[model samples]
Target: MSRERRKHVVYITKNSEYHCRDRECVAVRDRRSGEWLREHSALRGRLIGAVTAQGRLLRRMRIVVGMRLCLEGAGDEQLVMTSVVRNVGRPKKSATCAYAYQSWAGVIGA
Candidate 1:
């Protein structure tokens, strides 16, 4: 028997800034995207924390403004900050689906 690969929901930020609110919480914002990920929102704070932690771990640097980040994961599973690039010119296509968030919340009972 073979194990199936987990599918992750990708969230791509455009010219975003990652703010570590505290040791356990994090928030991300973009001028165009507004406040998509917030510590106090229905979305799990640990998810944001995991993104920041993994980004730092993989890139060995702090996330700064004007940096584009790709956050991928689902539910309470281990999230991954797949890409962290600076000054990449044009914004990539948005991969985050609003309906997905709603469906996740429904399934998880947010």
Candidate 2:
């Protein structure tokens, strides 16, 4: 028996973390649609847009102290927010890498 080869692509970005909603973003896609929806039941009456995971692959990315991410929401409003990842686990075979920058510094180490 032979195994299929997996295709790999590298994504370049200065930051890794994205300020998207928990349920309304590409983080959770319903099985039925096979499409990412920009809706969240957790946030009632509040509207937000979906962040596509398709284009969000960042490899070997490091997060700085003051990195900002444009979070998309309802009315197409973009909220500039900063964040930091306190801890990261070892990358799995299916896991991807990410980069980030902040006021402190930038990291090339994923």
Candidate 3:
């Protein structure tokens, strides 16, 4: 038996800086793509804290919410702009995988 993967589509904001120290620096992500879209912060800092603390669980974090992401998969694709994280809750007790989406994933790796 095999398990299915998950995927999500998001429009990442352009030319933005994410700061954790100053709340005033906070701002909702804006979609700069030609596609009309609503902005959402997909990943949160709480999740980062958990990942940082659990070094034994993952050797390195290739992805983090709020990070500027570019697709590295096979074939030439333009930089897929999207927000890394929307929100993060308290850590779960039984998380095994290094990458995860808490609430929803639109596709299983499209």
Candidate 4:
């Protein structure tokens, strides 16, 4: 049996509405398509951290609560709708990805 792959949907306020930092995971939004792109150090950071069993659980990430996420990889993945938020939290233990979401905002919660 195979476990179902999990899909993450993130809400991003247009830069006009709320400034974003993409704090949860580094992300970028397309100018025309409105697609958010996401990566967590090529998904390796979590795996490396997992080896120690101290941290690096993806789902437990508090930033994920209302993250500013973009679909990972290619294809038809998309967010349902964008929501407004005041602030987003940065993870205490995780290192920022190389891209580091400088191109866009971070997280999606107030």
Measured by lDDT, the strongest candidate is: 1
Q: Give the winner by TM-score.
A: 1
Name model 1 segments beyond 4 Å from true: 1-13, 36-75, 85-110
Clashes of 1: 0
> Candidate 1 — worst ten consecutive residues by lDDT sum?
18-27
lDDT string, candidate 4, 1-110, tens digits: 68424333222344412122332223434435644334422221121111112333234333332343222222233322233322434322222332344333444210
Model 1 CA lDDT for position 58 = 27
lDDT of 1 at 39: 35
Per-model TM-score on C-alpha atoms: 0.29, 0.21, 0.21, 0.19
- Residues 7-109, model 2: lDDT tens digits: 3221112333222223122121233543222342221111122222343423223322222222333344544222333222232233222211311132221
TM-score of 4: 0.19
Worst window of 10 by summed lDDT in candidate 3: 19-28
RMSD of 3: 13.9
> 3 or 4, which is superior by TM-score?
3
Error of 1 at 16 (Å): 2.6
Residue pairs clashing in model 3 are 12-81, 12-82, 41-85, 41-86, 42-85, 42-86, 43-85, 43-86, 65-84, 66-84
| lDDT, each prediction | 0.36, 0.27, 0.28, 0.29
Clashes of 3: 10
